[model samples]
Target: MQALLFEPNVQRIADETTGPITYQPGVIAPDLAASWFAALLQGVDWHESSRMMYERMVGVPRLHGHYAADDPSLPKVLGAALGIAKAQFRAPFNSIGLNFYRDEHDSVAPHNDKLHELVPHQPIVLLSLGATRTMVIRRKTPPHLKTELELEAGSLLLMGWNAQLNYDHGIPKLRYPVGPRISVAFRVRPGWSEDGW
Candidate 1:
């Protein structure tokens, strides 16, 4: 496996490995990752807007994507990182969903990607950049449990099968100040959205 950084250490989150979902921390070389991110931020058109959810699900506000046009270098590096991540965790991934969260108030509520748009048993690789924020992952049950973690810039978080199947993840709005945040979410979704536009 090609290491994103030699001697990179894993930061473990509080979760029962026996309980289906596992969140592992990975790191990429900042300089390299930043270059790709810069290219992406420059190459793609980004908009500040919100998306409404169907059937009263939580809505997503202040987000944008960098996937509407040709991005040769960004996707390659991201795909390579996903490859390493898959081998490291024994998970499979292919496509990437990139989002820019502009500030403290910009947020995404608890929700999972539509199942029909994903491949069963594959994982999602989320890479965070620019600034840090707390990502809350909660299970769907009484007592209403939750786990919150500060995802630092240049950090990678992987959500596997059980997570996608059983839990919901999101970045809640914080009243305090926070800088811009960019998240690159990579996944495997064969023949899902080929219009690529």
Candidate 2:
């Protein structure tokens, strides 16, 4: 009976699993994903940020943008995408965070979603658009088991709340050339701040 839930490209990564994570491909259809990617790339105001790393301020490799779910300034594609996510996983996701990887040079260091920033027990919904990038998810404890998924455009990945406590995930810089990609991450922010635009 459970098998029926994940037909086609759905993958429930549980073997040697330390956390609950589900990945499904072709959620938005390829053409629509491409169109949405184009819209988000141009319509959204992307920005750069730096954080104190190793006792020095270092520039982040990728661009970032954040928004509230009901913000009037969000592009139409985001609303449409959010509708799909909510329909599939009924969660109280009130925040949206976007990461723009301009090229292979743009990468995020392995890290987990900060617990203080998210509401307890709420899942994190992630949608991938544009170029496919491999995400490395690994256990933070002994044995350090790892898994890799090539997040294709139109794919959706759900990480359970407990997953963050047990694992770390991120995209590493690729040596080969790759097209730009956008990652739209939906979360339930505990105490939301300003993110209209």
Candidate 3:
């Protein structure tokens, strides 16, 4: 793995085992990221969500929303971001998932994305906004080695499809207080229905 330090605060992470993962901070610039964050905070139809975990309904730590490729209701800010991702990554992304971490308490468990729903060979692109947070990616098999990176405002993390099959990633909760953060994940799910996954 080669860590290309672009600046004091920005770096790129890539490893052979993890496939083509790349982290580019300042991809959207500070001012633009902040503006997009504010717009998404207000424009998105955010909702408190829960999932059946171990046969019990438990609330997810963050607010969530999804936008289909052709959905007229897709927020302009997100649509623009998708455009950028499409041009840069050249992935056929058709869906956008948004997760709003209100503070340090909000988090996501370490798990791979639903592979069946994603287009094969396409990369999953994550655009980070607002506060910086640590994202941990761990090996799925025994030994469970892990890598941690601070995802800062306007950063981009591209997770290759092969990486999803071999590792799990998440944002762990922090004990100390931190500002809000929002992540926009762009994925390609061909033949997606109105009833999404």
Candidate 4:
């Protein structure tokens, strides 16, 4: 992966909210992404894990889901990544979730990180690898608003307290041909998980 340069610019999608919604570029250096991806891929035991859901258009179980973040090596990579992401975003992240999109067929639907799983107001760091895809962040309520971003390879997107508290984010499916893409979402889950640390 080559070094990626993010032209830091804030694009305000809507007004009368809390604060300005910012979309900063190149938060995650491509070199770090490359090194981390190599470690994540080698360390993770990637497997197909999908939950069946009814497709509105097709009215069928289209396996609308993605791979799980069950990787042993993740904790290590996450530990290292937290430092890098923190320096870039200027915040601390305690937990991380890894998602692997094997191809165009593998994708994630629109959803937010349940407030219960995360701190009341903390940042969620998302790092994209492999290929480019559209990452959509939207306001969950009326005004029916949305902001779309093309997440390129070896890129980092950080949604801080202002963005996390007021908006929801997700990566939607793509129709064009795409290769394997990995996204490691680093967040601050202030409580606990089944895996006792």
Task: Name the best candidate (by lDDT).
Answer: 2
After superposition, the stretches of candidate 3 with alpha carbons farther than 4 Å from their true spots are 1-17, 193-197
Q: State each model's CA lDDT, in order.
A: 0.66, 0.87, 0.85, 0.62
Cα lDDT of model 2 by residue, 109-135, tens digit: 999999888898888999999999999
* Model 4 RMSD in angstroms: 5.1
State the lDDT of candidate 1 residue by residue for 137-196, as single tens digits. 777666557889888756678676556656788899999998887788777775644454
TM-score versus the correct structure, for each prediction: 0.75, 0.91, 0.88, 0.72
Best by TM-score: 2
Query: Cα miss at 62, model 3 (Å)?
Result: 0.6
For residue 88, what is the lDDT in candidate 3? Answer: 72
- The TM-score obtained by model 4 is 0.72
| Number of colliding residue pairs in each model | 1, 0, 0, 1
lDDT of 3 by residue, 1-197 (tens): 11222352435454656656788887786778888999999999999978999999999999999899668888888878988889778887889999999999999999999889888889999999999999998877777777898999888898888888888999999999999999999999968766555
Select the stronger candidate by TM-score from 1 and 2.
2
Candidate 1 backbone collisions, by pair: 95-187
lDDT of 4 by residue, 1-197 (tens): 33435564545444435433455556557677667777776676555443446743332212221221233434465666666667766665656667877677766667666767777667676777667878787887687577788877656676655655567766777788887777877777665444523
Against the true structure, candidate 1 has what lDDT? 0.66
RMSD of 1: 4.2
The parts of candidate 1 lying over 4 Å away from their true place are 1-3, 11-20, 24-26, 48-50, 53-60, 66-83, 86-92, 192-197
